[model samples]
Target: MDKNLIALIKILVKKSYITRTDLEVETNCSKRQITYRLEKINDLVEAKKLPPIEYGNQKEIIIKTETKNFLIEILRKSYNDKFYYFDKRERIIYLYIMLFMNLEYLSLQHFMSSLKVSRSTILNDLKDLKQELAKENIKISNSRSKGYYISGPELDIRGYMMKLVLLSLEDDHNSVVFDSIIDDYHLESFQFSKKTITELANKYKIHFVGDRLDEFIYIFIFLKARLKNHKNLTEEYLGKPNLDIISEMKEYKFTGELLSYYKDTTGFSEQEFHYITAWILAVSVGNFAEETEDKPIISEIVDRIMIRFEVLSGTHYNEGPEIFKQLYSHIRPAYYRLLFRLPIYNPLYPKIKEEYSELFLLVKETMKPLEGLFDGEIPEEEIAYLTMHFASIYSKKRDYEEVVKKNALVVCSNGIGLSAILYNELKEMFTDLNFYLPIDAVKFKDFDKPVDIIFTTEYQLHLIEQNIPIIKINPIINPRERYEIIRQVYTLLDLSVFKQPSLESIMEIIWKYATISNPTQLYSELLSFFSSSFKLKNEKKEKGYRLIDLISEDCMNLGIDAKDWEEAIRISGNSLVRKNKVTQDYVEKVVENLSPYFVITPLVALPHTRPEFGALSYSIGITVLNRPVEFGNNEKPVKYIFFLSSLDNKKHLPAMSDLLHLLNQKSFFEMLDGTKDKKAVLEYIRCYTSQSTISSSTME
Candidate 1:
């Protein structure tokens, strides 16, 4: 049978309905080639005395239940034979599995014999493998006497193995081939059977999803293999601390029982037991075996997190009991995951990081207290989930009516050129503000029908006498003046508005306007109008909040003289304190908590503490050093320091997301290096934020 036909059959069996186009794309073949492969697959199915799959009207290849099952079984039994003539990608996968699973040295001849390929072909595959492994910091160490073997940091190797296993699970087409290799090598052997582990888990009432059971099984099997080969993880590698708290818990007892099964076979050490304890804690087990007495402990932690989040974001979720309950439930499970160093796989990890970066960071900071309990840092995956919980409560508590749009009057003593520039700049900075065209400062007194605030080139006594807030700004609107204007506007404005009208309101309006003779037409028009209006409002709001809107020239330092990371951090943080964004104590607290410094990138560092550590507002201070400074061992050297002082964790997330996006760009450092003037750098940032805001709005 043709290899393409075999691959196509494998796909159709796994998927209920796959488009012909998808098949063409995956196979890198033309539609005509797909048709030929499909015909071959149908012929094979007929020969095997099985019902054939057919292409539906929509050009989706549909496989019946029986046909899929039969094909899966047949493929499983004969996978090795069909795997002989493999493509380049398939060949690489096989090599990956061999290197990952093999305990001893592998020679060029060994691969040649196993693959039944020429020496040059095997050598080329090794070369490709070497390149791929290098990307992950894993290298194939070739010894003239000992043979070829894989070597790298243990963590990196295990991470790559986990990724490979996950890929195999996801790609069902290659799973059979991978399984065959596992079985042939007797690599599936475990000290404790899957049944024994499952029974123990159920006996203790541990809550793990079905898929996670496979993870547990494979983990134990791998552990057994490592023990047999005397490849023990060091005490430092198994850095789980103080399992005494859960010593009396049912889950702990269950883990003990599970370990007992492997004690005789593997000679499990205390370190090994501690390692298993971490895994047990990290897995999604519910309620600490229903210890209702411990509920307060979890609730207390949740309360602290919520309070810190509220302070950082300048928002409150204290009034919501549902929020507390939800957080309490999540934190209990998360506590174990953190304690065990088990990182869950969140599919929304990237999106969450992009959209709610500040909130995510806040959650990470809030959970720092728990790190002492776990004796390790909480993984980003767990932090992402916690961010979602807090975000949910924040969104629910947010009052749309509180975000009222404000009207402003701009007064300029200078010519129309300065006034027009100021008007446009203010409009861009304050998205929620509606500004009247610039009027002469002399006309300021005559104009007032009661505007929320007045922006003038000079503070006027008459405007102040009217009891309206008067903000003084330079006519040219430099970065510092712009930041002050924004701060003043935010302080003066109500910052809340009524929620947008609902569909029901639109329907009622349509009913009121319609003649009753054309109900369908009226409904259509009303729906279109409401949708377009809603879309416009959302776009305007999104484009209004630029990243540069949160930054000011006063808080930005281009050439800071710092001998060490501490000095650099202090310099960056003190800028925020001077601006009253945070207090001196906040800076001190940040420095004190600098043991495990948050190195954002090789060139950048973000040093921050909890919002309640004396942060007065949501602000970020940037400091670029004259030269790079070393933080400590295991930390990257830093030049750019972003000191974040958030009033509330939620509000500054969009700005944080924008910053991350900017930092990810290759030219970000280049642009920073090219400028020492605060205004020039601010302009570059402003332009970037403006472009990003527009692009995101368009995408939405």
Candidate 2:
């Protein structure tokens, strides 16, 4: 039999259904080859009088539960006492598991025999394994008498082992390999079950999701195994100062109660208790009991952070008590993690950093004061979680406001069955639009809701006379149809689409006035000009607004002489004060709060304080230095400075967001560097801000 067929039989015995894609990955076979092999396996199964395997409705391979055990037994017998061949990566994993799980010294002959490989091959694998372990600060120690074993700080070893276990759980193929390791080592079954953990959680009123509960159980099992092996995670392994927050958590009591189950069985230590408490702190995912004594401090700190966040981002979070409660819940666990120096992994960190760059920075800055409470800095991973919380609230608020502003009516033939489905689909797709109850085609004329557009399954010729744009869509919309409908909706509502200037209109004046040596180069430049100019032309300008209105020539300084970042900040802030936009005290406050963390990105610094800090009006001041000045960290030196002052926290948000967006653009910085004239810089700012607003609004 093919090795791929054997692998498939193993996976099928373990799971009722496995995806064809997963089978393809495991067997390294094409889809057609998998089908052919499944047929051959079924032929063999029938010969043994077992049920035939087939694909279920979801296109996953299915085998009856009664037949799975027989199939597994037959496959094991067919192995004929041959050891499975492991690839290089698999060899490393096998070695790590052996060293990590084995309490007794492992002999070189043991690995060679178990792997069915020669001694030199095993030695080469061990050499590669040692290099891999060194990256994690783990070492493989050898003694002539005791053979080889892994030696590391117990916490690091546990962390690495946990990662390996998690990897196994995520990949079915890896789980199969991991099971073999468990069998080889004769590892004990998990001491604590899910029911016991759930019961303990309920008794203490600690809420954990199903996945978190699984994680806690795994952690408990690992801790028990380590204790049974007489390997303890010491206080020095944790290396964190004693925090009052850990003691205050109700999870501390829950941890003590849960571990009492293993106390007489495996024995426990103070370090073991703290280790379990830290795991609980890290894994618990829901709100804690509301009656805790530290609620006041949590609430106070949340309030202060939100206020500072509002001032820094110029956006208000006014969801009231619910927002406060949610933030408080997240902050509590986060506080424990920071206090104990435990790391929380956020898989979405990269995407969050890329998409919500401004909000991420704002959350990081707002967290500075809270960090002082623990006398340590919060990692970016923790801040990303906070960013998600705030960003979620902000998105909901924006969608709510937009829904109130725009309404749409759906018309269908039956107006009940398919209409309801279509209405729900459209509502989910266009969250900013409020969708009303569907109306039958016959009653469409009588329905009135002052809607912005009419979406119908069938074309309505009469609705054309009513001056309302009618969009025709299929009752069951596919992806392409849905996209077409959305594009039509936006086009009809004049949100995303705008008229572009004609090429002739743009080139007429330039061609009439200037002589061109190369028409190709001239046309390229003209096309670029028309693109930028027309984008600005189509932008909806706010009343009483212009770039010069925010930052005047008097407040703009070029080649400013400054000794350091502090002086640089003061010079720009003094410009704002001189223009009567802010007070001198605001400059001092801004300078005092300057930190390397506040560097928005490379080569730019935005220094500002709360709106209440002596601001006369909402304004910005710009300063460009001839040379870079070292900020808090020399790694990110500053040459461009923006001093912001706002009369109201929320009013300056648009400008601040626009400024940040502009800074992200390479061309904007190129223009700033190439020119020292204030007017040219102001024009670039004006055009970029206007274009950004239009683009942002259109996206909504």
Q: Show where candidate 2 strays beyond 4 Å.
A: 1-94, 109-128, 172-188, 235-239, 242-249, 263-267, 286-289, 293-305, 341-343, 364-380, 396-619, 622-700
Listed in order, each prediction's TM-score against the native is 0.53, 0.55
Q: State how far residue 175 of model 2 sits from its true place (Å).
A: 4.5
Tens-place lDDT per residue, model 1, 1-700, is 4566666766565332255644665677777887877777778778878878777322446666566666666565556564557667667766766676545777888777766789999889889988988998899887876577777765466556655554555344244445545565677443336788878877876755324555566656655555555545564465444445555456667777875675443465655565565566555434423654346677778777776554333344445676666566567766756554444565445655555556665567667666777666777877877766665555412112334367788886533433554565465555566677788665566785558887765443345456566676543333323333443455456444323443334455655676567644654465455434433233343332346767888899887779888889888888888899999999999888774336655677777777777989777788988899888565578888877876653456566657767877878778777778889888888888778742232001
Cα lDDT over the full model 2: 0.64
Report the lDDT of model 1 for residue 146: 54
lDDT of 2 by residue, 1-700 (tens): 5666776776665432245644665567776887888788889878888888876222446676556656666565644434566766666777777777645778889888667788898899999988977988899988977688888777677767666665544332133454455456655443335677788888886765223454456546654655777777665545554545556667777877776665453366666666667668665543534666556666677787776676557554456677777677677667666765555555456656555555666688678777776657888988877876775555312134443556889876421333544565566566657877777665667876697888865443355446566676544443334433554565557664435443444455566778858754665565455444432223442232233457788888887778888888888988888889899998887777665544666787777776676888878788988899888665688888877777643345445656656766899877877888998988878777666542222000
lDDT of 2 at 156: 70
Candidate 2 has its poorest 10 consecutive residues by lDDT at 691-700
Q: What does the lDDT read for residue 312 in candidate 1?
A: 36
